[model samples]
Target: MTGESLVYVAWAAQQMNARRDEFIAGLVLVTRSEIRSLDHDSRMVDLLNASITENVVAAIHFLEHGGVEADVEAPTAALVYARALAQRDVALSALIRAYRIGHGRFVDEAMALLAAQAPPEKALPAARELVHRAASWIDTICDRVGITYEQERDRWVSSRSGLRQHWVNELLSGSAVDIVKAEDALDYRLDRNHVAAIMWAEDTVATRDVGDLFDGARSALGEALAASGPSLMVPTDEREARLWWPADRIDCAGVQAALAEREVSVRIAVGDVGYGVDGFRRSLREAERVKVVALSGGPASGRVTCYEIVAPIALMAADVGDLRLFVQRTLGALASDDERSESLRDTLREFLARNGSFSATAKAMFLHRNTIQYRVAQAMDACGVSFDDPDAIASVQIALTACRWMGSSVLRQTNPTP
Candidate 1:
């Protein structure tokens, strides 16, 4: 190309650089809309936007400077994004497609600038040089990012954590696999009595160091449970992990004390103890169910929830909305979110739990018999139920249980007074 053509090409590249924000926005918008998998979550979307910005900046630099034959170093953000996509199990083709689409758009924009700004003779030659350079840059960058993706994927799959997670998933899925081989690979037996716990941070809790949180929880659980054999931990994501101890019993109080002592920020949902491989799978499922209940109830559900305590509510956790509606419908004004209503419901629930014994309910609630009687009468009046009817009694009991475990979720959302 002539010096005049090179000058026009440089001007077009500079024009793109000047409109860098526009280019990056358009590219990210197109990529996100076209490749759904790439836009999985907020974190991924941020990564994608950063990666495109870096790539566009680098591509514009490449065009302005004549570095066609030299090695292309992909922007750090771009490489990091590629590795993240690989870790997330996104297809490499998706990454390559994003590159090609962006390249085409970049070349098209450059051609448009050359057409608008350059003389006719300069525009064609400059457009050709611009396209060639853009194509070369994409080819090199894609090759590097592609290699990065594959290498990360390989390393992630072959890593010890990865293999262990694989086996856990297989077991969780209830697929028939050789238990002996799975045990050998995991280095944790599936034949023993196990207590599984699903541990995760509350969204409100900032997890500065996931490794430390998980390690501390493990050590605390092992020491608290007094486990003789090895324990297993499999991370489900950056924020959550599954843990199991080879113990027939899990003292929920002890576990809570241990977590408090260590100041671990994660909440734990534990399963009832179960034996053998089937028990292993069962224990994990139970923990998962307990975790669901705990999450639905939020922090008010407490930091450590065990299947033994929350099993009744866990069964209904799959449809909390429906269950919430039921609680409100059954409890009536008693389900109102207020101190007075809550006190009434608590007294009535205890009264029923103690089999209509006002004295026992008073003993349990640390209130006098007259107070329990008055509150029970108030709650019964609010519920508009007759204890004489068995169905009303049953429904009231169930609603109270839902309220106790589900907390405010199953309670009526009453507006506060102005």
Candidate 2:
């Protein structure tokens, strides 16, 4: 290297040291844009900030020393940061992107600093050398980070819960395997009556201490199924869990009452009772479907929903666009959002629910028989439906039930009536 180039490198290094905070801040912004996994993860973001600070300090030191060399006293911070991110389940792609972005930003800032501190004639060669050194340094750090990430991931995969999760995933994937061995590995019986459940916290902040939430769910579920025998629970992610218990029959009302008494805010979907291995798998599938319907129904916290009760609504609403069209076509202006229309829709719903008996509908709605008849006539007229047609009555009933389950907010988006 020329004497002039070495002098420029030293001058740039000094300037970087003086403006260390600014360099670190710029690097962090670039890295954040590239590493999307860091979003909404405060702990990971803090670790990344610390890593950037250490990296900036190290870069300044390397520039001042004029070359990169193996240093035993101060280990690279990038490797430590990688381990932390891997432990948090950040993907390898995100890590590589972060490094690439940080390297690019560092080179740009170093070149600008060099140009400002040194003569124009010397800046070009010094900038080239600095780029080479920075690239080499970043490459070495990335390699080390990759190694550390692999080690951490391997360790995590071999852990007990990790093996259980892997086994569950394989079973769910329908891979050809021995069910007996899988059951043995999971330590849960598959050859029995099973009731599947999917549980999750409604609040994101409550998911931070997921272990505590899981424990609470386990205890509550155990109490609810105390008469049913042993149960198995699996943590699916930070925010959700899948569980099942061996029971001759699921007392859904009893389970709902038990969960409602709990202090924790959890939403639970209980599947229909099924027998043996197929039952276990089917129940889980049903539970997952019920979870979607429950979420759409509204606030699910401290609520246990049984699939059997909502199955009709879930089936009809599965094709949402079609269901919305069906509702609009069946109800016409009766599906309007105005208070009068809403009241008429409710009256008609109750009237039809009573099998066209005006007395029964009046008793249910606590209105006079004439009043109930007037509303039903209004609803039928507004909807342009024939009371004599059985299909029309069935369609109107189904649409009303769907709107009740799906809520007004969902219907308002696509309702044909104003």
Candidate 3:
């Protein structure tokens, strides 16, 4: 390419770099057939077109980040661009070649030919020349970059998957329901709680080990997970993202070192040791939250920071025996206010003691089944448990345990506050 052509291509690349959607739309129109079919005004069509545009977007981003150096191997990007601007026949073959050497020029020529539709007889020879040119261009680029096409392809795939999983995993297993819903509406399938984190260069991670991502510290991470733990990495999208392994003894020293950088300045949270996925979820949430709210104030990443926010609830769950006693005694003293709560507790115990059959419990209390249910609901409601959730089961059970230990206090008709 002459200096004039080079300057034009460079300027064109800049335009591509800055206005990705428009550049990619132009790319899609490089060939005659695609040019004829795209609906300029349809979001659905734009979305359909995004599959190709996405690759261009990434390439443009990398180019912008790397500067205008031709030496920067825009590997794995041509195929995306080529496939998106499917102007010629053998699109798939063309895609495959874009990863290899010598194919880059062929792509440029093919795209040029695609832009100019000649009669079939002439088009055939021109297309072949274009392919040859592209293949040669790709070869030169590969040699310049010193990376095999296969290696680039692998890295590209891995990087895209890693980024996607990062987003999905963040939405899943998080308290961000609205975010999750919005993403799901966009057809991003994300099962809850299936993700992990990896340790990359501290604070300087422009992109992940596998991807060219934006600047936000990735919520989905992947790293060399310790083999002895629950699992530090899980398949966020089959490329492997780091997940919280509850049973694993956290490498605090290693983690601290990994996060020791002064820039990103975030903290990691590890969860209780035995609870498997639950613990992982809790710890991951805690760590992520701290990184968001507390990290701004300054705390290092990759270490345990209990987040103290959930301490009371956690402590109560850890040893509800004592908590239950306290709750029961407090309620027993306040019996004057709601005698039905105490009565319900006593009745439920006797009913349960006789066996879990609702009829038996109702019979022992000489109450209707519906009445018994109401009191049970009332008693559960009266307890600190949020009966609407799964967590309440244990809370209510603990309260019962405490009330049962009350000896005569339970049945004394002690004139619990009215």
Candidate 4:
């Protein structure tokens, strides 16, 4: 290349270095759809960003140095990224397409820069050289990265835990695989009745100590379920674990007692007991659903919540907007956060629970009979419904339960009357 051509190539490289972020943003925008389909893991996303930035910088360096020898090794960042992506199981086609799209965009930018800095005759040849250089470098790096990806993928497939996790994930996703084969791979019986549970750290501060917390939870759970039968616990991440044991073997009371005795900060959600292969999958799904509700119910809901008990509230509150509306309509002014309203609501809950027996409610709440009657009457008046109507009573009961479980933060009036 002549001195003038070298100047144009150098200038193009300078332009890329100066606006590196803009170039990367543009490339990402164009390839966003492909990238989204790769994997949702946070680590994979970080690798994608780092890989793009590093590749662009390396390309600029190659161009500035007059297209180095073909024997140069692939960029260290690209090789590392390829291995990471393979371990994450991203499709090879998606990885290759990202490179193709990125290089095409880089070539367009280089051409534009050359046109802006040189006359037409000089610019056309310089643009051709830049395209050749960029395309050749991309092809060489893709070959190296692709080879690394395949090797890493094969290694992952042959690992013991990898095979176990793969079968577990397949089972959970309802794939039609031989149960016997899956059992053999997992080393856990799927033919027996199962009760699934999920244990997780509740907060970021607690998450930092999750490894110890998970170990403590595992030990506690193992001891609790020992009498029931064999059990299995798998770590889904640093802060979360999934566990299962034979439904017939689990001592619910024992598990609860053991969990209470644990010193670590953790939450456990247990599914209804289910039997056999279908039951195994179903129980895990139910446990996950119940876990979401447990977290939403706040800390006062306790460390362990059974699926059977929470299913009603969890299903009812799934559509948050509708749940809020139902609460507002059923409780009316009682849903407000005033002391009087809360007191009346509590009195009504106890009165209903005691089957509308004023004496029973008084005895249970340690209040005078006259005070119970007054509060019940006040609650009925505030609620704008007669407790004599069964439908009204049922509605009020549901509203109170929803309010208690969901907490005042969600049930509080959105628009307050002065």
Evaluate all candidate structures by whole-model CA lDDT and list the values in order.
Answer: 0.84, 0.75, 0.40, 0.77
- Candidate 2 structure quality by residue, lDDT tens digits, 48-137: 888778877877788777764564122456666776665545688788777788778777877998888767777899998788777777
Per-candidate TM-score against the hidden true structure: 0.66, 0.62, 0.25, 0.61
**lDDT of predicted model 3:** 0.40
lDDT (Cα) of model 2:
0.75
- Show the colliding residue pairs in model 4: 228-249
Worst 10 residues of 3 by lDDT: 214-223
Across residues 348-403, which tens digit of lDDT does each residue of candidate 1 receive? Answer: 88899888998888888888999988999999999999989999889999998888
To one decimal, what is the Cα RMSD in angstroms of model 2 from the true structure?
Answer: 9.7
Q: Which portions of model 2 show Cα errors greater than 4 Å?
A: 1-156, 225-227, 300-302, 337-341, 414-418
lDDT of 3 at 68: 35
In candidate 4, what are the lDDT values of residues 1-418, reduced to their tens digit?
5766777888899988899999887776567665676533233455677788888988889888877657656777777778766655567888898999898888887888888888888998888778877878899888988998899878866776457657877888777888888888888998778889988776654546787887787778777766266667665544566888775555667777888887568888888778888888888888877765676567877888777776776677556668778887898878886668878988999999888899999999999999999998888887899866899889999888776666664466545568
Q: In model 3, how large is the Cα lDDT of residue 158?
A: 58
Candidate number that wins on TM-score, 3 or 4: 4
Residues 343-370 of candidate 3: C-alpha lDDT, one tens digit per residue: 8777655654665567888887788888
lDDT of residue 95 for candidate 2: 83
Ranking by TM-score: 1, 2, 4, 3
Best by TM-score: 1
RMSD of each: 8.2, 9.7, 21.3, 8.4
Ranking by lDDT: 1, 4, 2, 3
Instruction: Name the best candidate (by lDDT).
Output: 1
